[model samples]
Target: MLVPLTRQKFNQLIPLIATGPQYKYYWGKFPDFLQRLLISVVIAAVYVLVRLFAMPGFGPILFVLGVIGAFYWLWGPVFWASMRNAKCRRYKYSGFFRGRVLDWWITDELIGKQETVDNKGDLVIVENREKRINLEVGDETGFTAQLRAPLRVEHKVIARGQKVEMLVMSNRPDLSKIEEITDIYIPSRDLWVSDYPYLRRDYFPEVSRRLRDRPSERPRRRRPPEEQKGRRVEEWE
Candidate 1:
């Protein structure tokens, strides 16, 4: 049972949108090759030792064991690294629907900030400020939707005052899917710093000047009466 988001809930989620730290594939090199070579060498050495001890059959068994060990060692790291990368990857989407349909695809931070607990022990929270989403286990009744187990969430800290965007979805009454809450439009360091040196420095400063300043309202620009009238007349025209 998917429900439309209200305006008030949408406004609350505006602050949660932003990009996150880029993940680097650390084991993208030939570490596995070295591990396999090492295993093969060890196995061959063991086979030679067994042959010298009058055990010809043991040599073949050791060779087979070595081959199996080499494969396991070679691919084990690659498989584990790939799984880690996939789990950390983020997805963002626009809207949600009922009956196990695919929603939007997001590549940003999604957060579930718990706001309250209902009688059934479900968590009710504001999802991206567009709607109040709930998360709970068990049957979906008197609720908009429901999500099963295996829910995940991630938390990150950015420089304060950084602009972010957020997307929220209610998979179940107790679970609210929160998406990336950072300004994705901001260029990455490798991109901007290499091409635009001056602009790069402005993107991320060690000490934010705005944070150092005392709190003060920005001065409002006063338009002249004639300009205001002109703007109004232009709107009508």
Candidate 2:
């Protein structure tokens, strides 16, 4: 299922920039207003220090840095999405390939420790562990790849021998080879498991269906010549 990068597809993907679990896991730790307040305080403190010391030409530099930081903090997700989308365009061609899960395993990774006051009024360190699932998948072409993603509840249903689909990029027009592969999309569960989100969920299904329904191409065998037909001629001595 070859899907070309188009303006329409790109537009469809824009809305999903900060909507995935990967983004939520990190940014959700703090409220957006609190994060904004922290950034503002940091910028104001830097400005105060620069002014108090009377640093020559540092005011303009601080202003420039503040603007850049503010822009990034506010629109970082969209900026990142645009950059990644641009990078993906270089692949030019991509196909949706179906593969079966050969094996899978779960691991608990320590993300960080947080300081908290337990009900006892004593400060305690709470460990934050993110459950991750590692999967091994292989397709008919004998191409196998491993994918790792945060183990959300929807992914708990994954088991060995389950069919999964992924979008593979290739320079070849026929998609004869795999250059890179995106995260796996589990149709049965309507779930996408990946460290990063790549495809437009709303559009991927329609493209996959169209490609699967299209006729496959195969070379026709050459027929024997009329003179050579119905005869077993001996090799020249």
Candidate 3:
């Protein structure tokens, strides 16, 4: 069922959203505007020093520095403001529902069927039924990078009934603070249309095919004997 995300649920799942370490580091050290301003000032000073001593130039240097200072002053506050807005939006839209009425399950028997390799070139299987989604998260490089993660999933729509399709749209937790709604896919009516500008399906097909075709317990390819011996020697050395 489709429902609005409540504050209580937001508080509960906020930790599971897979926030990168950089978000925590920045969120903690500069929670206040004053600290951000001070840090910007320090950075601007360093830039000015480099310009004055290392790359002394014409009037353009000062002009560039001025523009940089302006950006520095606005960047931190703008970022925090966007973050606050995103949290509110996420609380407003987060929930559990299906993308369509096709009646799908995570395949309880094959949850957390990760493929790993051991030192002996043998495949190892670890069963974890507690995990919900089969997602591989990447490390965050910066604020822009962090925002891209949520944006990726912001374009998937949900359909509950025969003709009703609810578009799922929300705010990004970082920059690029645009409200985006995904395409609606109503399978019963055979209707599908995207409101978002860019809509492309590439990885979904390959992943779906793999999951549907093979058993989760399938073993991965083993490394050659020569490669295994080389790895062992390297480890010892």
Candidate 4:
């Protein structure tokens, strides 16, 4: 049965998932806070050295302070990653549902360029197009939910009048978020990133454990590997 996602739950999920102005979610770029953490490590080393030499008893305090600095710096990205995995899990599992894209619209809002790796492992650019897409999803139960997608053309598979398989929040079985636009159809890409909720049981879990768990979904050589042995492997369009 299709689980429902409530509007309220989606609201809470947003601030938790939108890691930064950078759209690394679609792009394979590391977490935004990663830079900050790297800087913190350097700062911590310098900071500890100064405090330890400047005062004896205060060494512990200085160390504590430095550790705190690292905590906050790492916290944001870690938290976001965890929550995103959680949602992804539900999306691939319990939240399994289906719906259709009633309509879609683009927004003028654009963030700076962010790097997102395509299935080809090429570093593709993901501009924050923030296409404001609204979809009306319905199931055999005659239940429907209005969903909005915050992703842009490059990051999403959504299109008007397209049938989609999606997942809802465990608690709220009516409203859904834009990320839940699982069964998306990108006309330009000509492939379904999400076709139905019947993905492998390990889909989300595999990703959570390792980013490289699944091979790139990008279309690879259609010909058998043996056939392409001597020539360049032609990519699927």
Candidate 5:
């Protein structure tokens, strides 16, 4: 279910948007069939070894049970992963439906802070704010929306009765944890009006370019006021 939020509510949820690090999957570049084939081979060999060596005939001889487990992993979990990707493709690139938000809230968790050397080799401390939205769609549909960030939130204020669009995959109508929250709910995302970014916290420095460690060139005197870009700049050279 997609609920329409008012513009005000949308803006309020900005700061609470969550984000995290981006990890590259080892087989990300491989085609789906190749990746599945590789996984099947690896899983088969690993289970065969475990069944031969590790399994001690404690009670009722573990003959083919491990083999069954391996097959289940390949067919059940692995197959579902492929189907989930397909569903996402259909809903994201295909069409979507407009619905109203049933209810929503922000959830925050600490990912810890770390000190790192920047380009200048100076030690800098970085703190990450990780958050997510637990929203349920009702009053229109029964789908639920959840997202883990490196996520961008809607800058437009969302209020009750505001119309929101949700991506729909007719083949697999499950929307519990597959759809992108921002892409489906915020129409402006397709427009890029929100100045605030939805990106990985680790890569955030690239977006805003934060200066850390050994930065004393910026003058701290009382010389300010240059209308270069049509407006008086606060920190000027």
Candidate 6:
């Protein structure tokens, strides 16, 4: 299901920049007001303390640095999200496509390790690890892509051959071909899996359904050879 991009549809996605789950990774689950309060307190303290103790020449330099740091800590994540959102504008068209999960697995990733002294005065190495889910999905075009995401509770239910939906982007006005893909939405489970939430999902299901039900015919393409069924490995860039 494909559709030509419109100014209205484009503006609707703008909220995703700040509301995406990826923002939690940057600043945690704290509420917006609480986060801003904490940042303000810290910045005020830095400004006051630096001015009180630093020597004449050094005080101005430290104050300037403090202001810069404050601005970054307050707005850095938003700035990054804005850049990503701007980048998406290059795709003049967008659409949803269906695929089946061909395979899935979990892997333990070592994040970091810290060396510490135990109560017994013995040295201990504490390791930090994260679990990630890896999925390989294929669409009707015979193209497959490997998607990796931080494992969540909902992901445990994902299985081979389960239907999956993804957002595809195209530069062409007609949406004749895909230029890039981002964000995977699992309709069965009502779950979204992605490193970053790129779609305004509230509008996704309806849009996908409407397009699929439209009377226009999709362009035809040759199917993969029968012998290649077990060996199909074409990947989309």
Candidate number with greatest lDDT: 6
Task: Summarize candidate 5's per-residue lDDT along 46-125 as a digit string, tens digits.
Answer: 76676666646632334465455445533443344344333333332212234455555566766778889999999999
- Residue 90, model 3, lDDT: 57
| lDDT scores of the candidates, listed in order | 0.32, 0.64, 0.36, 0.46, 0.39, 0.68
For each candidate, give its TM-score against the true structure. 0.23, 0.62, 0.23, 0.40, 0.30, 0.64
For 137-220, candidate 2 gives per-residue lDDT tens digits of 885556678888888887778888887877776665444556777878877777788876777667667765655576773322
| lDDT (10s digit) by residue, model 3, range 108-223 | 33334777899999999877554121111111211110011112232243222233233233342211222433333343443443322121222223322333354433222224
TM-score for candidate 5, residues paired by index: 0.30
Q: Which portions of model 3 miss their true places by more than 4 Å? A: 1-31, 56-62, 80-237
lDDT for each residue of candidate 4 in 115-218, tens digit (9 for 90 to 100): 88999999998886544545565644555666444544454555555655433443222222224444333233333342122223223332222322434443
Q: Cα-based RMSD of the predictions, in order?
A: 20.2, 10.9, 22.1, 17.9, 21.7, 8.1
Q: Against the true structure, whose TM-score is highest?
A: 6
Query: How many clashes does each candidate structure show, in the order listed?
Result: 37, 0, 0, 10, 25, 0
Between prediction 1 and prediction 3, the one with superior lDDT is: 3
Candidate 1 per-residue lDDT over residues 1-237, each given as its tens digit:
222233333323222222122211222337645765677677667656665785666767766765665465444545554444333232322221221111212133343455888889998785542221122211122222222212123112222222211122332222233332111211222111111011112233311222224264332222444444434211000
Model 4 poorest 10 in a row by lDDT = 194-203
Clashing pairs in 6: none
- Pairs clashing in candidate 3? none
Record all residue pairs in model 2 with backbone atoms less than 3 Å apart, i.e. clashing.
none
Of models 2 and 4, which has the larger TM-score?
Answer: 2
Sequence-dependent TM-score of model 4: 0.40
Winner on TM-score (3 vs 4): 4
- Residue ranges of candidate 6 with Cα displaced over 4 Å: 1-11, 14-16, 20-22, 29-77, 87-95, 120-123, 170-180, 216-237
